[model samples]
Target: MKHIDVKEIISSKEFIGQEITICGWVRTSRNSKSVAFVEVNDGTSLKNVQVVVEKGESDYKEPRVGMALKVTGTVVEGRNNTVEINAVPEGITVLGDAPTDYPLQKKGHTLEFLRTIPHLRGRTNTFNAVWRVRSVLAAAIHEYFQTHNYVYVNTPLITGSDCEGAGEMFQVTTIGYSNDYKNEEDYYTNDFFGRKAGLSVSGQLEGEMAATAMGKIYTFGPSFRAENSNTPKHLAEFWHVEPEVAFAELNDVIEIAEDMLKHVIRTLLDKCPDEVAFFDAHFEKGLRARLEELISHDFGRVTYTEAIELLKNSGENFVYPVEWGCDLQTEHERYLSEKVFKKAVFVTDYPKEIKSFYMKQNPDGKTVAAVDLLVPGVGEIIGGSEREADYDKLIAAMNERNMNLDLYSDYLDLRKFGTVPHGGFGLGFERLIMYTTGMANIRDVILFPRTVGSIR
Candidate 1:
């Protein structure tokens, strides 16, 4: 009577004996003189439903793998009450045909090869599981924040100020090619918006603005970077989850981040058992055990100075030299989490010169109140710090760096009017997905990855 999906029929036991219309792409089919068996998947889950069709019972267009079909059938029960459909040949319709040259058939494909066909990769079982898990992960993030009374803030994409102050931003311009820029600095002053603007590298600054007013706010949106890195972990564009909390210090934000991560991992285990199991078997062995271990114990916390000492004392030779003021490389981060802590660890109190200007300077005057969360497999999953609340101190820090004064007047106004001790951390959405799914490359988790010299 009504159209239903393959998942519904497979899940609902009462659907047996009812007449239903099912539409999906054929995964595999076998034809015979008396009967034809077809496996169909509707992208609802990792599993597929089986359909039985008798020859000459009605109009039966021979089905092929990758072909779209509409089949009217009566539900039947197979062994162990497995729900199946018996197609009425007269009601069958071949919606779309796939040629023999179909790129994807019933075979294994390398992840490298799949990247070339981004549009059609979803048809594969691996990608189907990846995207479905990604959907659930995103919902988990929103659910975790919303239930915690954090207001959702939509930060602007085009920003005039560089939040990280590293200047890795994609410029937005409307100047026509007909007019050559005699002065690069003068071009932006005369272009659209009447000033320089670029895609935001981080929504932390804007999120902080909302947090000062809303008390607790989170921003989940797309962020861009102009860095030309070709590493497997880097992306030109990615999704970021940032939560800013007013009246919260560095330790406060660290607690929130740990709780949020555990909550999402627990939710994923509860919701997507099959998808998680699939990845555990294929991508990462002992994946569930790793996440369970993470939630069961408290994450180890240590100072950046302490981490450097441990690394330096170790006998292993590192490619990059480790010093007190130097940044921690990915290899060093992984070593701390995997070998030293054997779980997720939070390294705190980084050198002030290496951190951003917004981070609050510590009483020691050498380091800032910044923390980086590193996991066993992934190097650095999050970076956050307690913001500098004093107006005079912020101005001094900015002036020391010779930052553009005109671009951050509004930001400074926030501190001038009403400022509170606030702190926040940013989580790369793709990196989390990769860690959860045991996906090695960052590009595999993203649907259409944008990296150095690659747009399509």
Candidate 2:
């Protein structure tokens, strides 16, 4: 008989009384004098299937938690309206034996402890639910873009330009720590690419190039940063979802961001019911309601200046005091979304001094046409801006920043050759997962999270 997944065997009653085979890792096992109860999970579902073994069975062996087993059995109606498997005679085989020293036990393990054993943590309830939701959310993102007539583009992982201008990029070098060169320029000349190259911090630049031609494009891939901050919200490597649209302005991309996020939330709530319920029950109470509330109403909108005024007058004791031209901190952002607006809010037209050089300069001569989407639980979930389409303005902005004009000649060429008011936004995929699943740490949502001094 074909091996049926534990998820299928437990979810439906069609397999009752039918002989079948199943393979999975033991979650928990209880052995009495005459019978043994083994709960097994194949990572297909949040719940497990109970495998009952009789003491007289020839091949019956006491299965331990974390042990991989293959069992041929007959599905039967279990107690309390559930389905279980009754192992047949000589039908139990141990594929892999986890000894008594197995790290995972029936007892609860803290998230910090699980990080040390990233390899085995996926078998746990929390990680299994997180990964399952992650898979569904990834697919939902693709579905949303594809159905909306957006072209999916793959930007290069390695690039010669820093998209965010922060200079926090991981250098991709062929040379080791050897003083085998004359100068900074000469050192890179002998290296691969014959110039400075690093893992991309954002795909927005290449994504803009694709958008100008393809009309609408988005890139979903891994992004790297070399920041040294050790925080629950920060990561060295994370997935980025960026969408660029031609003939679009700051307001247009803001609408796209809101609609795309709502669609993704609806998809998650509909498809991953069990996983969401588990997260809601354990991780964050009312997580499901929070998601529903987001989709129920329109996001609030305010200018950066207006937001600053609101914060200054709100009389809330803020850790970082609110002021004009100063970038809004998480406290301020959460206050606007959670306390003031009570929903997702868009703060737009920030001062050009604090914003990137690529953003379009507004008529006021002080602020850029930039916007950040702040949600209730997570602040600044999405950041985007209208590109500076005028060649002179872009050149002036680059020159003011003392940027290397030679490196960005290709990106500059896009403006010179019929640029049409293009714009885009980037969504940190892990941040979205953290908001949806209520997983507090950025480390927990990602598989094998690469954080400060932690690669394993």
TM-score against native, each model = 0.96, 0.98
lDDT of 1 by residue, 78-134 (tens): 777688898757767788899988888757889999999999889888889999989
Q: Report lDDT (CA) for all predictions.
A: 0.90, 0.93
Best by lDDT: 2
lDDT of 2 by residue, 433-454 (tens): 9999999999999998999888
CA RMSD, predictions in order: 1.6, 1.2
Superposed model 2: Cα runs more than 4 Å off: 57-59
| Per-candidate total of colliding backbone pairs | 4, 0
Model 2 lDDT vs. the true structure? 0.93
